[model samples]
Target: MFYQFPEDFYWGGASSALQTEGSDSSRGKTIFDVFYNLAPNRFFDGVGPNKLADFYHRYKEDISLYKAVGHNSHRTSISWARLIPDGDGDVDQEAVVYYHEVIDEFKRQGVTLIMNLMHFDMPAALQAKGGFENREVVDAYVRYAKICFELFGDKVKLWATFNEPIVTPEGGYLYDFHYPNVVDFKRAVQVSYNMIIAHAAAVKVFHQVVDGGEICTILNITPIYPRSDNPKDVAAARIADLIFVRSFLDPVLLGQWNAELVEFLGEHDLLPVGLPEDKQLIAANRVDFIGLNYYQPRRVKAKEHVPHPESVLLPESFFDYYEMQGRRMNTSRGWEIYPKAIYDMLMTIKNEYGNVKCYIAENGMGIQQEDQFRGADGVIDDTYRIAFYKEHLRYVHQAISEGVNCFGYHIWTPIDNWSMINAYKNRYGVIEFNPQTGERKLKRSGSWFKELVDANGFDD
Candidate 1:
């Protein structure tokens, strides 16, 4: 092996409740359920979350497959709606029993579990009441976190407050990709600020109730690059970074908002209001670690045209996406594949964020119509996916050699599951699932990953 990892390094994959577990009607409906009903055309092929990978009933089989693939650790999220049917009320006894069974199964397989308290699956009951935009929703989220801590924290040592906290506000409020499809900049800022507070509150509760458990949040950190060395372009990239990365990164990791971010929001009159104690709350409850979900880097240039003063403010208003001439791209998703961005991200964390403990929570390539890769031997020959993992893992190994405290690297998913807007169009799984028959087959990437895990690394 060219690049051996630490003996205790985590080797596994990640999945969320809504994406994998197929039990929507049994539990409380989420905003996703509501949105899909309202406009089924928005989703790919009109496939909703009603019936996903069926992990709810097939967790035992899934864990066996995970063990076969040499996964020493696994990450998954507990559905807020499933645990508490009404979003904020008495715990559902059935849900409690189900989760305990799942935890026990993982323990039976000797797989270390990293559980997230909330993914993007917010309960519709909460969404009906303005979701994160309302401060009351923060209290509701804290309550949910407390219940999770009291119930499952003893078994799950590693807990995440939320997964990609920025996506909620960015997609739902600003870009209209998620529920409540609003395009209000002020509401988006308010939602983002409230989510930070909610995360801090969850961390605070975790500390108060949980014993010997480490809590953190997963952030999708896409390093921003200037299109050119021009001063305006550089400034645009900086502003874009502040808006996308530092807005949540600073408060969670550094326990304070960046001065530049605050100034920019103030200048545009887009600051979230209320709770002078919010800063102290955030500072007092920093994460024990961080999770980086690196997929691609952002390339930005100065905006060619400024928006009218009366136009609503947005992060893209300060910068424009710059497409480089000869960049490697993922044709299925149209996302640039820059492996070095992982190294740069880790170096930034090491130099700027005090070298805090972190891990690659999610990273993988999603391809459309992957059935063509199957061979005569009944295996999917996903050599490109193998190469993608190798390239990214090389950078991860490089960062680790340089003393970055990254401990794990989990792929985006363990099995092909339903995506948000794309539905099941793109497959990012090591194991391929037959949507029609619910059949499972380990792909070539899965076999290769098993060898990599057993060897602790791979030869170049």
Candidate 2:
């Protein structure tokens, strides 16, 4: 079978600002910087945000490399901390000029650049004042969004509000892996609620400012699977899906909170403090599309035991993770390699979520220390990466064929970039990056991708 894709389909990759752009152009401090300062050892090799893939200095060359590697479209972020120092302060003229040049470069190379507003990289100045936990920070973020729209909207028609926004509150407040580490359930709820408001406010502002641009949110959607056909396991899976997936999905696409989620939170006395007008604001500003970042599936089961009434509460307090025996796993990242979950997710979107226009924002395998796979000819023989893409793309094609509104497929990244805590431990890129000398080389997967994008499909 000749597995073909739709005409005008977007074919490219996705990345973020702080992950790729090293601290440059008078960039202000970010939450990652603060975290590294507090606990440098937590990150791989003790690498920090200040040290990155150096996209800030090497974007021109890197863009050329991505284009050559067959990227007709790409997704990346505009650093809020870089553009407006402190998140709501003086606009950095140097940052402005730098971003302008970068966007122009993408246009010059005939690549569509989708600029994301935030990717868990909040400005430290705003974060210091409570980050998303503080209502004032929501306004600051909206203002930042407006500035980005007016500045880059002319050249960049595609924009995203946040990339995997759940990680912000989930990591920082619930798990304490991020800066401003706090383990308060109420605080986490408040942070997530504020982000919803912030996203809606930005959507409202974008329509008011930008004339002809499409704005969306990038959500990391992992399909939840029940351990068995038992009702308790199914219930656990449903609630977990509600908490992780629908929490943001409902608000952005349906323009309202999941009713069951709200009632459950209220019953548990865990609802975030909000205003009546907040609902109206959210209801009025739904996104134009969605970018679903699928990496793995989550296997869940009913709580193995009742939580102590006096103990602190968490999402896991109601459910337990189920490790399936003989499940296909990615040893490099410890994630399940279930490509069909992509099809299941898209079907759910079509059946339940109004079938919103969407695309595969990020789907790639991360292998640790890929340099060990390099051949004598200076090429990484990453046949595994190519096989991984083929498997996932087949599912993506199946979903589109069945009318799931999936428009494109973008891998996790175009080149090796820094990940939070992991740094560059797991390389998820078609192109390799040399951190020290800023060198790049096309891997075996890179050559394969160029052909795949050029043809818009591959044979089965």
lDDT of each: 0.92, 0.92
Which residue pairs in model 1 clash with each other?
A: none
Q: What is the per-residue lDDT of model 1 for residues 177-240, given as tens digits with 9 covering 90 to 100?
A: 9998999888999999999999999999999998999999999978999999999999999999
Error of 2 at 385 (Å): 0.6
TM-scores of all predicted structures:
0.99, 0.99
- Could you tell me how far off, in angstroms, the CA of residue 182 lies in candidate 2 after the best superposition? 1.4
> Residue-wise lDDT of candidate 2 within 1-460, one digit each (tens)?
8899999999999999989988875999999989999999999999888878788888999999889889999999999999998899989999999999999999999999889999999999999898998999999999999999988887888899999999998899989888888888778889999999999999999999888988999998799999999999999998898889889999999999999999878887899999889999999999999999999999999999999998889999889998999999899999989999999988988999899999999999999988889899989999999999999999999999999998889998889988999998999999998888778889999999999989999986
In candidate 2, how many Å is residue 156 off?
Answer: 1.5
Distance (Å) between predicted and true CA of 241, model 1? 0.4
* Shift of residue 78 alpha carbon in model 2, Å: 0.6
Leading candidate by lDDT? 1
C-alpha RMSD in Å of predicted model 2 compared with the true structure? 1.0
